[model samples]
Structures are given as C-alpha cells and as structure tokens.
Target: MKKIHLVWSFFCVMYVSLAIAAHAEEKIIQGKEEIEKSICELNIKGQIEKEFHLYVTDGYQEMADGEMIYFWGFTHAKDFADVEEIKTKAERNAKLLPLKVPGDEIRLTSGRNYVVVLHNAGWYETEEHSGINHVAHTIHFHGLDLIPALDGVPNLPYPSVFPGEIYRYLLTIPEDIEGTYMGHCHVDSTNHIMSGMYFPIIIEKKPNEIYGYTFDREYTLFMSELDSEYMETLREVGDIRRGLDWNSNYFMLNGRIFMDNLTHPLSTINDPKTRIVAYDGETVLVRLLALGYEHIFAWHPHGFHGLVIGTDGRKFPFAYEKDTLLIGSGERYDILYKIPDFSSKRKCLSCNYGPGISIAHDHNMKGMVSGGIYPHGPMTIFDIRPKKMTP
Candidate 1:
C-alpha cells in the first residue's frame, strides 16, 4: 500500500483552509430546477440533437476521514465562452458546480445527434511540479461505437485540447443502441479516470422507457475506487504510468464513501437524483456504472432482486433476476426493480421485507471498507418513505 502519511500530509493543511473558505460558498441544492441543473451536465437537449458544455477542471472530494482527495473532473461550463476565471472555493461554488468524481449525469435518446463541447478551463490546485498545469484532456465515449474523428483518443488528430481551449464532438448514436454507457478521459485514462474524470451516460429508447418496460423514476450509481496516495502522486508529479505501489483504498458509489452516504449532501442516498426512492406498485430503473484499477463490485441489495434488463448500452432479449449483481471495470448494467405493493402482505413474494428501508451494499469484501476501515466503503439505500414526506 502507498504510504498513508504522504496522502494525509498533502490533505491536512488543504482541508483546514478549504473548509473555512467553503463556508460562504453558494450551494445550488434549494429549488427543484436548480438541483437538476446542478446534477445534470447536459446544457441543452433538442428534439433532433443534445448539446453539452463540459468544463475540465480540478477539484477535491473530502473522504469519510475529512481528507480532501484531489481529482480532475468535468463540470458544466456556465458560460460557453469562458475559461479558468475562478480558483477559490467561493468563486468556484458561485460560478461552477464543484466537480464530481464520476463527473455528472447525461441523459441521451436513441438515434439522436449529440453535440459535446469540452472546455479545458484549467486546474485549481497550484502544487508546484504537479504537472497538472500543462496537461491536455479528452473525453472518450466508452461503450459507444463512433468514428475515429469523433472518438476522443489523444494525439489521434493533433496536440489535443489544452487549457484555455475547447474541443467539439459531434456524436451520432445508432437508433437501436440504448442502454447504460459512460464518457471518460482517454488521455492517460488510467490516471485521469482513476483521479475522477468519468461520468454516467444513459441512452434511453425514449423518455422513461427502455426495452419495452417503463419505470416511475430512475437513479444512477457510479461506482469507483480511489487511492489518496495514488492521487497525491498524480498531483505531485502527474505520473500516468501504473505503479506496483498503486493501491486503491477508497471505494465509492456516486463520489462519497458509505456511512457518509447517509449524511453527505452529495451522497447516493441524499442526492434526490441518485437515491432509489419509489412508491409501492411502481418500477424503479437503476443504471449501475463502475470503474476501478482492480476492484470487482458485487452489488447486493438487501431485500428484493432486480430484473437485469441491459448492459453496456445493449438491451437484453431475455431479462434475468439477480440480487447481488457483479460489476467490473468499465462495465454498466441497467437493472429494473419493481417495487411491489407492500400495503398487502401477499402482494409479491420475497418482497415482504421491503417498502421501508433496504440497504444496498458492495458485497465485494474489499469494497466494504475504505483504507481498511470496515463499513466505510460503498453503501446506499432503497427507501420507500411516507408518501407525504419531503426532504
């Protein structure tokens, strides 16, 4: 394992300063529209095309232990014509959404042209020798078949998208392609994606419909693993090569570790967009996407089994039922969970224990802990609250 001291040494001082500075930061978690605006990176969606303005910037996520793990991610660019104007917590919080590790959710429709504009705004942390200041980034649409021109492999065309510049991608997704997919940085992908440059992408057959099934609502769980020391090395010297010392010690679902998920403002359970909430007799669609250096996540829901509907943006001809779903690096699964009518004891067999609170955790033994601490890795919930209750 990477020396723990090096990790915290970089974080300890930053946390003290960033924590105080972020106190007055503006948070967009109030109104419904504002919340959606914060979580979704898609800027515009037309009938024939969807447009996105993604800003490549550096940010930090405070781990369960209060250590801020430095990462590079994609956030929404409020203005299509701006670059690297903000650096402080207050400035970033006011002007841009703090970058999430798995970036942001982008919903797509089958057979539509997608226009993605990526602006390399720049990094925030000014650690000398981090090599972050001179780096170029690109977004490779994973699990999607696109031409070499539209595909985002670096140097395939030229020097790549550097800071203060923007790259435009005109994507055409086939009509029959609709399922769970992802977009991530391809240049030094091992370092960038592990440092938090990926995001969830869902291509639907149509709105709220997939593979001839409809659901009341949907949630996405972006699973990832991070080694604070590994990130420290990246931010210290921008090492793109994989090292034998690499040890991913923090496992996450939607950016935050477990236990923290129960309370963190940006966690899976607290984030209304990601928390699996459903009324009785309704179907809930869950898009599970994962990435890690060497981790396999066995997703285990406590009470009910989910119907495995799709994978890697392809619909399954025959759906299967699985309670503990296994996910590997770069894999995406679309699962449909039909919440039975819990008002009646005989409504559906095996759902007798649901409708209140059900814990969904990573059964991959190692994923249950962060930095070797038990019960602190990826864990979330499926809640069916009182119909009138509000967050």
Candidate 2:
C-alpha cells in the first residue's frame, strides 16, 4: 500500500511539471506568430547621455550665424541604447501614431526589449490644424527633398531658436524576424537632416526562428537629401507658404554617400562615396526606401536588375527582373539577386549592370547629375561575393 501511494504521488508531480512546460511553449509560439504579421512595432526610448547635439552635416562646424551642424550631414546613432540605455515609453508615444491596432496594453521596460505591431509603419500623416501640422501638411517631403521643402515651413522669429521641433513614433518588434531595421523622419529639412537624426532598430524574432532563414536575409537603406540654400530660405520665410516644393537634389544612403570614399571630399555627387555592407551570396534581399520629394530611384545592380521579391513591405509571389528599379517617392522595394557566375571586362567581378553583374546605382537619369558641383548624395552599393571567399 505504501509503495503504491508513493508511485501515485510521483506521477502526479510529473504530470504537473509537463503541464507547465507545455503552457510555456504555447506562449512562445504565440509570440512568434504575432511577430510574423506584416507591421512590426518596437518600444524605443533613449537617454541623452550628455548634451547630445543633432547635426545635419557629416563634418562638424558652427554656421556663420552660429548653429552647430555636423560636417557633411546629421549624426544619429545606429542603435538607440548606444547613446544611453533607457526605458521605453511606447504606450505614451503610441497615442500619437495614426493607425492604432488591436492589442493588449503594453508597457516597455526601459532597458529590456518588448514587442508591438505597426498598422501603418511607414505611412505619413499631417498633424491637425496645429502650426506644426499646417507646415508639415502643406508639403510632402520624401527621401532627400526635405532640405528644400522645409524652407517653406514657418521659421523661428529668432535665429537662435529652431523653427519647430521634429516628432517621431515609437514601436516594438514581435519575436519572429528580430534584427536591425532602419527608419527616419519623413519630412523635408536639408540642413536639419544632414546634421544627424537617422537611426536603426532591432526586431527580436521569435525563438524558433531566431537564427534560421525562416524568411530571407534582408536590409533597408533610407535615401535622403539636405540643402544649405533651402535652410536659409526657411529662415527667411518666417511662416509656412505654398509652392515651396522642390525635387530632391541631394541623396544619401544611411547618412553618407554610398561609394567607397574614406572622406567625402566631393559634395556634388549623391553617390554615397562610401560602402555599407559586403553582399556575396546565393540569395540577397535589399530593401530600398525613397524619402525624397519627387525622384524615381532607378536602382540597378551593376551586372543585374536584382530580382524584385517585395514592395512597400509586402512580399510578392513572382520575382520581377529589371536593370533599373524605378521606385517613386514614399516607396519601398525588396530586391533579391544571386552573385555573378562569370566576370565582365576585368579579371574581377565589376559593379556595372549591362552584362556582368557587380554594382548598384540610381537610374533617375537626372539624379545621376552632381548636386551643384557635387554628385548625387544617397547612392549606395552592396558588394556580393560567396561566403567562402569573403575576407
């Protein structure tokens, strides 16, 4: 009788343990499913470790009137916490987002990560009849066009005061495809932008898919512009005005030129005179976001049209092949292509798009022109090679 009682107790304990384990697994699975949905949200917050400055140029200098502008352009961080690890006030910020979704009330622990959903992650909307809204609403700035457009917005009565404060949204990432994604303010402000305000965020994919290629390897590059002339115009206008829209003349990938230049000596070319990443593989996905006013991005791989796998954050069933990807303003394209099989004119694989596939650039015929004396600004390239050969 005693032995039977002990055996029964042991079985009951085992059963309870299994039930708890099963419940935990279910919660994790649910988290992953919620994450896979199209719109991803991240609860982002930060602390200004010190008196941090927002710059518009790559180089750092004070304007003649004495405003600190980063040399070349603005200086924002790739990650929020790199400046200072702080808690996230996502719910507080979410109130400002236009497209609110159905979900539980969530609070983000400052340093810890959390998940949310974006009903309209990349969509832009104007504020109400408020002064800020009227100016931001009067014009729609995309990619590099802000430098010129912001000129028309109401300016500060004093030079020492900024025209208006820029506002941004906060979100969280579900656990499925957690990694780095890029975002920027979608308004026009050339000098303000080049000063340094763009940044990147991480989405923690659900545990099961945390490491695998459940989807595909992908990245997003935001292209924008800044203008000294436009900044001065805004300073002069002192109030919002119509008919101020100008095509984006400057361009940048991430924040700098996309070419392979250590120091961006040339300012006329939008050609990002720097390189971002090394891309050599069987399948590569490049997400392109055009934030300028009215330029079509003719993104062509040097030797390939790059397969079109997705658009505006939505995946497509069939791939569209083309030499130049004509992306309109406020558009996003997900491109995929394989590494070159053979060489072109030179011994090594080149970055040109005619026959051999090696490079990527904008096909906005006019955008290829230099900004004033400088070349286009945001042009970038991904060097794709086999993983085995990567140094």
Candidate 3:
C-alpha cells in the first residue's frame, strides 16, 4: 500500500525530530559539596536531532486522602522516546536522583520555587565557564521531625547550578564500609533522565567480619516509579511538583503494595481479631531498601533459610546461606530469618495463625506491575510473633 504509507510517513517525521533533539539545548549540574565531600551532576548537551525511544514507568493507583495511595517514579523519558528513525547521536545522555523533597508539599512547594531560580548555589566566583571537573554547591534540608509543618524548613538544600538541570541530592556515605555504591548525574547532554531527574544512594555498613549480627526489630524501605506524564513535565518545567508520577512498574519489598495478602478476620480467642504466631527458633531482623530502578529484592523465607547479614548498607562477614536474597538499586540488606513452626493442626494459639508465611518479592522480571496494574506493584510481607502468645 504505497510502501506502507511511505514507511509510515518517514516514521512520523523522524519521531518529531528526535523529540526536539532530546529536549534541546540542555545543561545541568546540581551540587558537589567539598569540605568533606558532596556531589551531583547533570550536563546532557543535546544533539539526537533525529531519532529516539524511551519507556519505563509502570505504577499508579491513586486516591490521595481517601486512602489507597500507591506511586512510583522514573521513566528515563519512556526509556528514550520511541525511536523510529532519523539518525544522529552527537550526544544524548542521562543521570538522576538528587532528592531533597519536603517543603510541606504543595507539589514540592511549587517545585521548590522553580528550584530557587533553576538551582543557584554559592562559591562560584567564576572559573571561566566553570564547566567540568567540579564546582557547585548549595544544599539544605531540615524536615522529618514527625512532620510538624516540615519543622523549620532549612536543612534541605541542593540548588547549586550553572547551566544545570536534573538533580536530587542528599549524600553522606563517609565510607560507611561494605561496598556497592552509585550516585548518578554525570550528564552527557541530553535526555536528562527522560526529564524527571534521578535518585538512589545509600551507605550504612561498618564494623568487622562482614556484618556481625545484632538486632531487636528493624524495617527499612525504598522502591520507585513515576511517569505521570513525565512527572507532570518536570513539575511544570522544574517547579518539581510531586504527588505521583512513578514509573517503577515493580521495584518491590515489604508488602509491595495494596495486596499480596491481608485478610485476618474471624476471631474467637475471645474474638478481638487474632494475629500472632511464630515459634521454632524465633529470631527476626529484616531491612531491605532498593530505591530507584534496577531490581532483585528477593527474600523468600517460606520454611526458613535467611541469614544474610548485609549488602548495600554493608554488614556481612558471618551470616550467609540464603533461601534467596539479592537486592539492588541503591541496595541494603540485613536479613536473619528463623520463624517456622505450625503443626498440631497448623497450631492456632486460640486462633492466631491466619497469616504468617514470609515472602518479600521483586525478582526482577519487569518488577511486578503498576502501569500494568495487577495488584498494584512492588511487594511486601512479614508477620511472626510468639512471646508466649496472647491476642
């Protein structure tokens, strides 16, 4: 049919001229503190001037206040903006995750007032286009005191730019020992993380022989996704609004989302809604956070086999066996499983053995689904108790 409509009209005008040449004329750089260390950069120059294709955002099932809230982020601009054909790649790159959100939300407080005038840090008297090898800092952040009006908004900082764009910084890995580290934004001049920036960096591991063991009760979390139309077009041009634009599709752990299972009704131990069971070694300590893309948050302690001491946040020199544990994306692991006992007719301490299996997913395979929406996305679960059991 006329050569398939002339090759689909020359592939939709070479895909809108390579999505306007990978977001035309782009240049970014956030902060790179140095009095002891700090870094975040983005300088994608731009020049696809022809072809593109990028997609990867699969998360979202919102409700906001009426509850039911599940979100995720990162689409790297839909993986690159649907490339059809045109040719030309002088440059087109990406790097993100420099987070510092907490201005009492109003969509990240008008995207941090357009990010303090598109990022403006201090101490740059001028090094002639201060272009590479470093030079730009202006960090702050003081939220999270149980969120009382973001309690004295000051400590949260990272607005140090110079032809910069694409950031999210908050680093402090003073060699917390234990290996595996990654903090993006070295910029190449295009596709700046599909234009939502980026995030994922964690450090917490130090103290001999792999990660000795010591715990009482722990829980750490991190998983991402967002593509609400490219984070609402970068919060409307870098104003940076955030309520939900996730694109992680499946980056899971800790109850991944809405329901992997949560149903324990039918009480009878005096019926107050029972739930508490776990005996036969009884030792619990789990901490696994895998922020920003890249998967592998697997930990299935069905009958028990977990002992891994640490991974991304360091700690592991004497406690390794695995029933399956492989976390990534700014990693962090500190498992120590030992809770599997039921027999005596699945032992129901009066009626407290409804749900207690142990499973934490995200074995990659396209995460779990959100943009594909099957039971939300991600994954999570953990419930085992036996202090002599009561109710």
Q: What TM-score would every model get versus the actual structure?
A: 0.79, 0.48, 0.30
Candidate 1 residue lDDT tens string, 67-129: 788888889855433444445546666777777677877878877776787777777674776
Residue 28's C-alpha lDDT in candidate 2?
47
How far off is model 1, as Cα RMSD?
14.6
Would you give me the overall lDDT of model 3? 0.35
Better of 1 and 3 by TM-score: 1
Per-residue alpha-carbon lDDT of candidate 3 for residues 177-257, written as tens digits (9 for 90 to 100):
432222222232112232223333222343212244554444434444334454434333333233234354433332234
Minimum summed lDDT over a 10-residue window in model 1 is located at: 24-33
lDDT of 2 by residue, 314-365 (tens): 4466767877777764576656655544332222245433332244566665
Q: Identify the runs in model 1 with alpha carbons over 4 angstroms from their true place.
A: 1-48, 78-94, 260-267, 343-355, 386-391
The local distance difference test score of each candidate is 0.76, 0.38, 0.35
RMSD of each: 14.6, 19.5, 20.4
**Which scores greater on TM-score, model 2 or model 3?**
2
lDDT of 3 at 169: 33
